[model samples]
Target chain A: MTEPAEPHAHQHESLPVAARVRRLEERVIAAGLTTDAEIDELLTRFYADAAPVNGARIVARAWTDEEYRDRLLADGSAAAAELGFGPQTSGFQLRAVANTPGRHNVIVCTLCSCYPLSLLGPSPSWYRSLAYRSQAVREPRAVLAGFGLDLPATTRIDVWDSTSEIRYLVVPVRPAGTDGLRPDELAALVTRNGLIGTAAV
Target chain B: MKFPPGSRVRARTTDPGHHTRLPRYLRGHTGEVVAVATPEPLPDDVARGVPEPRVEPVYAVRFHGADLWGCETGGHRHG
Candidate 1:
């Protein structure tokens, strides 16, 4: 067998992240640690259970219930647990930031991609990209504009950096004309980008 | 928590050349404590695998963009 490439060369491999993950899974399965079916089952359950919809559910409840909104604002993990979304197993505390008529909120991890994955599922590739991580904090308005979110000039923007063991979830303002909608319908309107603070609900 | 909410505090300046949760850009900069997170083991120690790591409160500090990058707008929340 040919010797493996050096670390520098290996880092430059053109394989996509999914391909690399599949290769790792193959190695693990070959070593008798786990079966491919078992891994697939786990992934299926994870995607089904822990997704952006979970966050949408929470936001829907908050929009309909003022008390619940207060609780979510005060203690996000506890409020999420009330709705069957378990606290993050990573021990990262979840903090919810609400957007208002005068202010908007956005989240980024300038150091690394530390997101509230249990609530928002996998982060978008741009969330972890160096360009975003650096620019989100430096030129937030420009970045938001790129996402098609152009807030009024008077609206203040709060950019949150996931620098510690605290993960943040942006609670976008409930859309107008949705007062007659049911909770589930409201939840359906909440998008992953809205929860990430890159877009409006 | 050592610093209560709304209190202005400066991130301590240090470059120990080790793993730490505190971002480098925040060092030597002052910000207001917006919230206090539950006490947890110091990440610097946790990364180093120190036995019996010391626990401490993690404050969510809000640094204005003008102070952080000399920009004329925005507020940055850093924990």
Candidate 2:
């Protein structure tokens, strides 16, 4: 017989996840447990210091400058910090894997969701899903295909399994046809998925 | 100490009752060490919320598709 329906299936359906988070933040602030200014400071810092936009910019800079790319590849922590990433304070080391003409790279944490929060912002729900964690390792090609990235079967696919000790960022090869774009403009083309190796830059 | 890049090693198939950083799928699988990341505390110990400082170097291990899955297309490798 089929198992009974979950008891909390519709209990919290009235409020979306974002709404719930907002409401909780508001209640916590109103309760005087945390000062509003302090909370605002944390929120502001999160948006500015830890976001995909920063990751995109880093990727873009590397695409344009060979020296910078070398530095980033050699010492991601220092290179990222030079750009004001300053994310290493959280104890998670950031490792960068560059995609080449013959190889592609992807990142996942199968056991637990380990992501560079201060560098790439919070992990997306889909990135942490059990399906992604399992399939990305078992059948990476198919998993990437599901994400709309169909790398040539001949191109090598490298999947980095992150742990709490370290997280990775994929540096996708620069696409053709944007020879005249400035660094900032090039960054606009880099999406979070590109940095995660699930999509092309 | 770090594993030299290109070193071939098999992930240990250990399941301590405590915590662990190695995922199950990777345990016992053979892969080539791609890069040596800076060392840090054992993730398992970190996950257990212990303040211990015991550490190990993290390595980027690249596994060939053929080594991971029996039904594979290209001989592409994944890290």
User: What DockQ number belongs to candidate 2?
Assistant: 0.37
In terms of DockQ, which candidate is strongest? 1
lDDT of 1 by residue, B14-45 (tens): 98778888787788999999999888899899
Candidate 1: residue A124 Cα off by (Å): 0.5
Off by over 4 Å in 2: A1-37, A88-90, B49-51, B73-79
Query: What are the per-residue Cα lDDT tens digits for candidate 2 across B18-46?
Result: 86766666678888887777777776777
Clashing pairs in 2: A158-B78, A158-B79, A159-B78, A159-B79, A160-B79
State each candidate's clash count: 0, 5
Tens-place lDDT digits, model 2, residues A11-33 = 22344865888799899988989
> Model 1, residue A19: displacement in angstroms?
12
Task: Provide TM-scores for the models.
Answer: 0.87, 0.81
What C-alpha lDDT, on a 0 to 100 scale, does residue A62 get in candidate 2? 92
DockQ of each: 0.74, 0.37
Candidate 1, residue A177: the lDDT equals: 97
Docking quality class, candidate 1: medium
**Every candidate's chain B TM-score:** 0.92, 0.77
